[model samples]
Structures are given as C-alpha cells and as structure tokens.
Target: MIGRRLLVAAAAAGAGWVARAAWGTVPALGASRSAIRPYAAGSPRYRDNRFHNSEPSSSLPSGSQSGLAKAFLTRGATGRPRRAIPLAAPLAPTAAGELAVTWLGHATALIEIDGRRVLTDPVWSDRVSPSAVLGPARMHPMPMALEDLPTIDAVVVSHDHYDHLDQSTVVRLARTQSTIFVVPVGVGAHLRRWGVPADRVVELDWDESTEVAGLTLTCTEARHFSGRGLARDTTLWASWVIAGPRRTVFFGGDSGYTTRFADIGRRYGPFDVTLLPVGAYDERWPDIHMNPEEAVRVHLDVDGGLLIPIHWATFNLAFHPWDEPITRLLDAAADAGVTMSVPMVGQRIDGVRPPEQKPWWQGLA
Candidate 1:
C-alpha cells in the first residue's frame, strides 16, 4: 500500500509541474503569427509573410552554432558581478524638464523631452522568458517601484523580444496607467491580447510618425529580428526619433552596425542626446547586437551630442564579464571624443547640464 501511495504522489507532482509551465506560457507568449500578420502585411518591410530588415542580417554567423554551444558550457559566472550593484534613487522632478533621462536598467528608460515624459521599453519583471521560472533573471532589484513612476505621456516599445516587451509589465501598466503604447507595426496585437485597450495602442511602420503630448515619435530602421516563439520575424523592430519643439532625442533600441543611422541622422540630425544599447553583444552574432566600439560609431553616425548607454548592468544576457561592456564603451567614447554620462540605475541625467561620469561599476565588478 505504501508503494502504491508513492506512485500516486509522483503522478500528482508531474501533473502540477505541467500545469505551472502552461500557466506561464499561454499568456506570456502573446499573439501568434496569424494574429500579427494581418497588421504587419501593410508595411513595406513585410514581404512573403515576414518582415525583412533594410539590409540582410543574420542572427548567428555561419557554422558558429557549435562554437557558441561550447562557449556557453564553459562560460561559468563571468556575466555576474562580484558584489551588489549600486542603485540610485530616481529624481523626483516637479515637472518634466527640457531634456533628461532616467535609466531604469537594461533597455528600460524614462525620457523627459520638452516638458513631456516618455517611457521606453519598460520591463519590470524578474525574469524575461515565456516560462516564468526560466530565462535571464534580474541581477539587481528595480531601483524604484513601478507604481511610484510619475505620470507617463506614452510608453514606446522597441520590439517584441522578451527582454524588451514583457507581458507582465505590459499588463500591469495597462491596468495602472493611462499612458498610450507606441510600438512598431503588428506589436499592437500583443498589447491587445494582454487586455490593453485598442485605442490606447498606436502602431507605426518605419518612417511613419505619430504625435503624442506635443512630441513627434518617428519609427526608424534598425538591423534586428523579432519573435516570441517558433515563428520568427512576424513583427517588425525599429529605433525611434523623439522630437520636440526645441530638442530631439534618438533611441537606438537594439541594432547592429548599420549605415542606416546616417540616413536617420540626415533626416533628424543633431539630436540633443541619444540612448543606445551597449551590451549582450557577441562575435558570433555581430549582425544583430553591436559591440561597445560599434556603439560609439553609431553615436557619431546619428550625430548625437550627449550619449547615455543602456542594455547593460541589469541582466546577464552575454558571456563577457559583468562590467566589460561599460569599460570598453568608456575607452571607445574617450577615443572618439564623445561626451557621455554613465548613470547608476535610476539616476537621472540632465542633457542641458550633464554631470561628469562616475565609475560606479568599478569596485562591484
């Protein structure tokens, strides 16, 4: 009788495990390709049922899969910091300033431009994956609670990647805030599935512009891919141009070294500040994510003034040392004679009167 009871308990445990995994996958996966295809079909980038980049790009180098697999096996804990990462309290500005930025972590940031507040790729979840218990977990807690964020005029999403477009964060924001979601074409399907009102979601294709709170948000080209499951490139990815009356800001969501930045610069040249990705880059996938040196090139290509780096220091998504990206970025920026501000998480930097760079990640790494 005891043996039979043990077997029964094992069966119950297996069932519970399956149920938990399904719970995370069903809603978190968002919309399928069929649901997204209808909205994306109208985009010029969409061809043969998939969105294509302006230039041909590969997610991984040819025949590098085996090498990448081996590298992952021997990666160890090189991507984690030795000690707790420092965090700074977000500045509570009485009103939106002319030009300022608060780097929450990773690709998430709050851009204050011309007296309007815009949140970019805000991911407040612990893990970024279809399964709640799996994926790249946060290295440090959020510096501040999401509920404490000031009134947001709009939330801009770069793509549908798990790290960039989190399902839980979108749902929570939809329930709590009245801010509209501005995303690339077909991304609105995911928001609608997450219970966000259709009217609150604005979808735009490349070169398309929308007005929000007296600011013009233009979807620009980015050399990247997008997907949440087996079907890839169902949705479009893009960088953004946030222009106001007096100042403009460029948001390099996530892209590789592409000459398209020069085109964007000519159209919207001389931005006051730029927020660019500087992490999760690997030689095997050089066409998708830019290295630190390449990031400096992009800053110049876009004619950016004050550079604020993002997409690092929050999660371990690459094999390099925890602080390698920032170290390399600082050296490259210095060599290029580029002005930059490396803010601690939640620390705000005013573009009009920028502060000096502080090496906060030095001792912790």
Candidate 2:
C-alpha cells in the first residue's frame, strides 16, 4: 500500500511540473482589461466596454466556426514552404541614411530615415505565444542577432498581438537599449508590466504624434482588433507615419482594407516608401486582414513611392501556401505598375534607389 501511494504521488508531481512549465510565462500576458481601461477609455472608439473599428468588421465569417475547426484539423502542410527558405545577411550601414528598410522576417523591420532608425513590431523570440512551449515557431532562424542591431531611436509597436509585440523581446530591449517604446494607447500598460520603466514608454491615440530623435512618429488609424488574453479590444491598434526632415514613411501594421488610406494620403501623402503587410489572409477574415491585391491598393491610395512587403515568410499564420502571398503580390504589382522591392530576410534596400526586384523566392516554394 505504501508503494502504491508513493507511485501516485510521483505521478501527480510530474503532472504538476508539466503544468508549471506550460504556464510559466502567464505574467507576460500583459495588463488586464481593468488596468488598461483608464488609458483607453478616453478614445472615441472606446465604448461598449471595448474599442471599435471605424468600419464594421468581423474576425470570421458567420457560420465559419465549425468549418474553421475542421479546417484547422485537416489543413496539414498548407502554409509551409516546400524546402528551406533563403536568408540574407543584413549589412549595417555606417550611419542612418535618407530612407532605407531592412526586413528581419515577419512584421519586424528596421527603418532608417534621415539619420535615425525606427524599429517596427520587433519580435525576436523562437515562438510567439504567452507560453514558450506551444505556438507557431519560426520557420527559419533569425538572420541577425537582436544584440547586433544598430542603435534605434525608437521602437514602435502597432498592437499587443503575440506575434507583433513579444514580451521576451521587449524585456531584452529594455535591459540592453535606452530607446523609448512608442505604442498605441493602453499598450504602455503591457510594457510597464514587463519591467520597462514608465518613462521609457510613450502611448498615443490615433492622430497623435510624438517626436523622437528629430523624427515625427504619428499614430494613424487602422482596422484591427487588440487583445492579449480573453478580453478583446481593451487597447488600441494603429498604423504609423514616420516623417523625418527629408523623408517620410508609412508603416501599415497589420490592418485590413479600409478607405481611410485615402484620407491618410490627403493628410500625410506622398510618402517616400511604404511598408505594408501581404500575408495571412483568408476570405473568412476578409475585413480583418487584407490580401496581396488589397495591399497594392493601399500603397497607391497612400500615394506611396516604393512599396516593400512585410508580415510574410516567417511564421505560418494562415491556410494558404507559404509563398503564395509574395507570388500574388508580384503579379498585382506588375498589373498596377507599382514599384516594389521584395527583399530577402534581413536584406536592406534603399528606398530612394532600390535594387531590381529579384526572384530569389522562385523555386524555393
């Protein structure tokens, strides 16, 4: 009988350890709805106990619950590449230039404009989830180490999504760099929870602008939802307008198709370059994520010069093939006569004088 009791105890202890490991990063989930309400309540979009988009949008189509469930279970190997994806070694410039962008896979990119660098949606973790054990892991390794990045003037976070705003990366940057974090309103609560000093965080609502290192970072509108846990839309999500003395750039951080792009162009049009997302799209979530063709429309709507695509080629977040996004984007851009540069992971391209569009991704898919 004593032997039986000891065995049961051992089994229970093992289960407990597994549970602990799975939930170890729960604290990194960021501030709760109550903690964020104070900062978010003032916005016009905040009502009905949450933020709302300017246009009506649903995350998934009606009656898609069961179909999506079955799809998730049956869609094997739908979003992965056929073989290994190629990567390019990022070449660090001696100094910040007029305008250039180095894509570091997914939505992370370094934008150098007028002698300053701004990092957008910096996620450097192996997996993007509250728990380290489970989530969509990186398809390819990081082309460059996080510590090797050049001095950045500011880190701009579009929203609180696990993929876009990683808690581990935030903590590391806070400990290593002295740069301030510019985020949409209510997201500062997350940074504060992650041990980033309050002074180091700046929160802004739509249309608000903040200056960092002689550049203007404006929080613009986006059609997207925000949440880190169960409660949704407690914080704001946004696109950004980065304007320098000599150049301006538009960063479309995870948004759907919206006519607001025309409005933004009228206000802050004629950008030197625009970084738009071109992946993870589905008909079910049509209003929440734009397809590649819609991305081209956004660039033209904003009167952008050179278009560089982001938000693809890292983690698989959709049901389409891995390379389909870029493939469709190239065809659409060609039809629209849109000048674009599809850089390899970690490759930097000058916005003013971009290199020829290389078909490096050809045959890799």
Candidate 3:
C-alpha cells in the first residue's frame, strides 16, 4: 500500500510540473477548460492626442447571428467545385524593387515595399487551433521554413486569432530576428507574456500612426472581432498602412465591411498595392471574413492601386472549398476592373510588376 501511494504521489507531482511548463510555453500544447478571457475590441478614445482609439469592449458581444446576417444580404460561398491544388514554392523576390509580395500561404505574407521588408500575419504552424493535435490542419506544407525567411525589418500582426497571431510563430520570429513587432492594442500583453521585450513591441490603436525606421505605420480600422480561447474581444484589431517615400501600401488584416476603408483612403489614398483578406468567409460568419466581392469593395474603398488576395489556401478555416475564395475574387475583380496579383505560397509577386500570368490555383479547381 505504501509503495502504491508513493507511486501515485510521484505521478501527481510530475503532472503538475508538466502543466506548469505548458503554461509557460505558448502555442498551448493542451486545451484549457476555461474559455479565453476577453480584451478590448476597439475604442473611440485617443491617447497623447495622436489618433482616435476604438477598442473591442466587452460591452458588445458577437455570435452566430453576426455572420448569418451578413450572408443573408449577399450570397454565401456557392460557385464551383474544388480541385486538388498543390502549392508552388520559393517565389524568389529581388532585393531591388518598389514592392515584392510573397504569399507564404494563408494570410502570411512577406512584403518588401518601397525598400522596407515587412511580414504580415505570419502563421507557420501546422494547425490554427489551441492544441497541436487538433483543429484546422494545414492543407499543404509551408513553402519555406520560417528559418529560411530573409531578414525582416518588421512583423505586422492583424489580430490575436490562433491563425493570425500564432504563438509558436511568434516565438520563432523572436528567436530568429529582433524585428519591430507592430501589433494592435492589447496584443502587447500576449507578446509580453511570451517574453518579447516591451520596446520591441509597438502597440497601436485604430487610426494611430507611428514611425519606425523612417517608415510610417498607421493602424487603420478593420471590421472584425478577436479571441484566442474562450475569451472574446479584449484586444483591438486593425488593418495597416505602410507609407514609404516612393509609394504606399495597405495591409488589411481581417475585417467585414465598414466605412473605415473610405476613411483610410481619404487620409491615405491611391495606395500602390493593397494586401487584403479574401477567404475564410461563410454565411454563418460573413461579417468577420470578407468574401472576395466584399474584399474587392474594400479594396476600392481604400483607393488601392493594385490588390493582392490573401487569407485563403493553406488552411481550411471555413467550410467553403479551398479554391472558392480565389475564384470569386477573380470574377469580382474582373467585373470591377480592379487589377490583382495572385501568387502561390512562397512565390514573390512583384505587386508593381505584372504578375507571372498563371492560374496556378486553377490546378486546384
């Protein structure tokens, strides 16, 4: 009896230690029973008189109704059958150019715009769930490993979704390069928790603009919500505008339709390139994920010059077939005459140069 009890005690102690270690590490290995706590959504407050801060307040809540309402107004994902689409690799980018965009699968992109190289919403993990064992697994392998990425000057995060602001990816980035982390408000807490130095993290509220390495980084408004675990919207989310001496580009992290795009355009219009979300949309949650048509509308709203579609491929976050998003985008863009560039994963598309004319994704259809 004594020996048995000792063995049980030892097992309990070991379990406790494992739990502690898991909490300390990120990309949580196991699931927690409790729901994630909510953070600020967006705010109308301003700090230091720089810009208006719109936050995600617990005051408002979101549910299935949100996406359903959006889908009702417009058609849901209904178009063509999907085909097995294998991703292309190593879309090499030249160092000399006004802007070079490589879609690293899903919404992750490396943007070398106007001499400054920036990474957007990087998710280099196999799954976008709280645990590694489950959730939306990557449809294909990452075109290039994170270690292979060129020296990035800055990392711009859109929000704190498991897919968007991945903890494992953040840890690797922190280990690889001490890039400037420009993120939305309240995201600093997550980065701080993960051991990223506060100074390296620049938290911006909506409409707030900051200058890093002589480049102007502005947090524009995005019509979206946030939450990692059970916790809902506590942190704020936003699109961003990167203004360089020669040209300007906008990175729409994730959003529904809102008038803020026009506002961003009026303030910083005629962008040379606009990187916008074009997938993960459904009738259940239309407001959160912008369909290709809505993405095109927002593209025009921001007064973007050329559009580069993202947030599709890599992972099946929504129920729609993997190829539906791009097909819809192509149709909408052609109707509107909005110029677009669609590059494969790890393919560096010169947003300025005419993209290699190929429907590589057609292979999937």
User: Model 1 off-target regions past 4 Å?
Assistant: 1-15, 62-70
- For model 1, residues 193-309, the per-residue Cα lDDT tens digits are 989999999999999999999999999999999999888899999999999999999999999989999999988878999999999998778898999999999999999999999
TM-score of each: 0.96, 0.95, 0.81
* Backbone clashes under 3 angstroms, per model: 0, 0, 22
Writing each residue's lDDT as its tens digit, candidate 3 over 35-96 gives 11222333453233212224332212356556654644454433223555556677544463
Query: What does each candidate score in C-alpha RMSD?
Result: 1.7, 2.2, 6.8
Best by TM-score: 1
Off by over 4 Å in 2: 1-17
lDDT of each: 0.92, 0.92, 0.75
Q: What stretches of model 3 exceed 4 Å from their correct place? A: 1-84, 91-96
* lDDT preference between candidates 2 and 3, better one: 2
Model 2 lDDT per residue over 88-187, tens place: 9998887988889999999999999999999999999998888886778899999999999889899999999999999989999998899999999999
Q: Would you give me the overall lDDT of model 3?
A: 0.75
| Model 2 TM-score relative to the real fold | 0.95
